[model samples]
Target: MGEKFPEIQGGGSLILAWQVRNKKVLVIGGGEVAAGRILNLLNADAKVVLISPRDGLNSEVAHRIERKQVEYYDRKFEPSDLDDPAITMVLTAIDEPDASTQIWKLCKEKRIAANIADVPPECDFYFGSVHRDGPLQIMVSTNGNGPKMANIVRRRIAANLPPNIGDAIAKVGALRRKLRVVAPGTEEGPKRMQWMSKVCLKWSLEDLCEMEEQDMDELLQSYAPDQIPSLSQVRLGEEPGTWQFDGSFGWACVV
Candidate 1:
């Protein structure tokens, strides 16, 4: 007899950060929703080509056009617009459902990614509420279920994050680069990964946030050739038994 397996639950969307910098994306409509979409695209460095009658544009989008920030065509979306093989994506925010659907179908035919505003079933992607700091972006997605809920969760997370968290990331990134130079190449790959994991598990977020150039120099000393220092030596005077990791923010704490 064939072995039985437990029933599988529903599927999930694969969340990812797309690289759209300098890529041409077609935008339809110029209302409030489209205005928001345009700004999001611009933030990603996407070259936006907006198609809507001049009067359809909101004050913000209109100003953007005048400032030459967006490539504008004061006309309705035409199927021919998709012909610009350079337009790798299209987003529609017009009130016309039929028009939006047609745009989606055209994108499908052309094998281009598309996001049809307010129409989940037809969208190739959904925008999430994003929390941003210098070189840091955290996106919360509800998979088109509840955008407002995503925003609430994002806000809560932003409020709870330790101060100077982004600064910590930047400093750690510099340490990582230094380590790569010191260790150099795949010869130290396994040891390097192990050391990095230990660092995260042992160092509290506040400790990392407070990391200085001198602290980093001392930390690297622990990774000297043929030696991986124990917590007692590398963690200063802190005991390993008192360290804990809080999963809520995925940071270390001293309990």
Candidate 2:
């Protein structure tokens, strides 16, 4: 029998966490697709502007419009809508293919990314199913191929994560800040990163959550007493000052 090779899939996209806060997002049409995207933008604190006939809006979206939570323009979309400099991204969910295509073309000319519902070719980006735990967020995507599968994976991953994972991360972040202040030297960057990696490998989630500041200080003294300055040596009232990255992959502290 001949050996068989598994088939490889293509068209994967680079996913990123966009800082859409205070940015203007435009949506065309008033159906379920538009409603979902609008809600997501609102959650991110993005200023959303919806242009539609206002007759066929989803019930929840209509309720939001009634409450004036979203800026709604009850009219067909016009090319002039893209002229607004505040508009960063556009989403089109109109039933008419011609209208969606026109909006997408205009967005291209305006250098704005656009997403057209049920039309992958017309989209500059695709929405992913996201799971969030405080500052921790996980996004799963199938390159606009299988959204339901992405949602399933996201739910599974969210369920598997420790409930106190966010707290653990926060504790580690605090420890890192203290390390930077007490151990500001050329070699401190790599040493700190290596120490953090060891900490993650050695400590459990519960251990991290229960770690106190005093314990962290004690641990630092025990681990690298020679590298870190004594607590009494650090000026209590003075700021730690800014850290600048040297071209040689080291950090220089500028007071």
Candidate 3:
């Protein structure tokens, strides 16, 4: 029999962690959907400007306007709204079908990315269900196929995750910074990474999260003899668990 290649699967959208910090985004509605978009944008530290009629404003959107959280005009969206070259993204969430389509068209003409709520086909991108804990974030997307289902999946994933994985990450970051300074210079980069990798693997998630600032200080101070120490050595009488620490990393091991 002749050999054959496996069948190919179709491609999906390229999910990205786009940074919109300090950039301007235009939102062309004042309804609840637009309010949610505004919250998400503000969370990203984007400069948001909203356009909607004064009467169309939902309570949440109006509260934002009252607090001056965003710059908005009390009027409907117009063609001139896209005149600003600084606008990076546009979102519309109004009941007017013709107006929403017009906004999407104008955005396409201006080469500005857009998302029209409930109209996935017209959207340049989409909002995913995000579960965030401090510096850790998990996003669930259905590629515009299902929104509610995405939320359900996200909720389930969030429920199953460790309670404070974010804290563990923060602890790692703290150690990395102190370790870098203690062992600085270009030659120390490899040593630094190898040592940190061992630290991440050997120290369980709960143990890392339990580490405090003083523990870090003592850990740094105990960095004698190749700068590797067991948890029991550092803690004095505490159990070291099952992790074996050889204090050696990288290649070239002779048997």
lDDT (CA) per prediction: 0.80, 0.76, 0.81
Q: Residue by residue across 86-194, what tens digits does model 1's lDDT show?
A: 9878999999999899889989999999999989999988989998876578999898999999999999999998768787677767778878988998989888776
| TM-score against native, each model | 0.77, 0.72, 0.81
Model 1 scores a C-alpha lDDT of: 0.80
Q: Tell me the deviation in Å of residue 109 in model 2.
A: 1.5
lDDT of 2: 0.76
Name the candidate that leads on TM-score. Answer: 3
Q: Lowest summed lDDT over 10 consecutive residues: which window, candidate 2?
A: 246-255
Please give the ranking of all candidate structures by lDDT, highest first, separated by commas. Answer: 3, 1, 2
- Residues 69-169 of candidate 2 have per-residue lDDT tens digits of 78999999988888899998999888999888988888888899999988999999999998877567789998888899999999999998788877877
Clashes of 2: 0
Q: What is the lDDT of residue 50 in candidate 2?
A: 89
lDDT of 2 at 172: 76
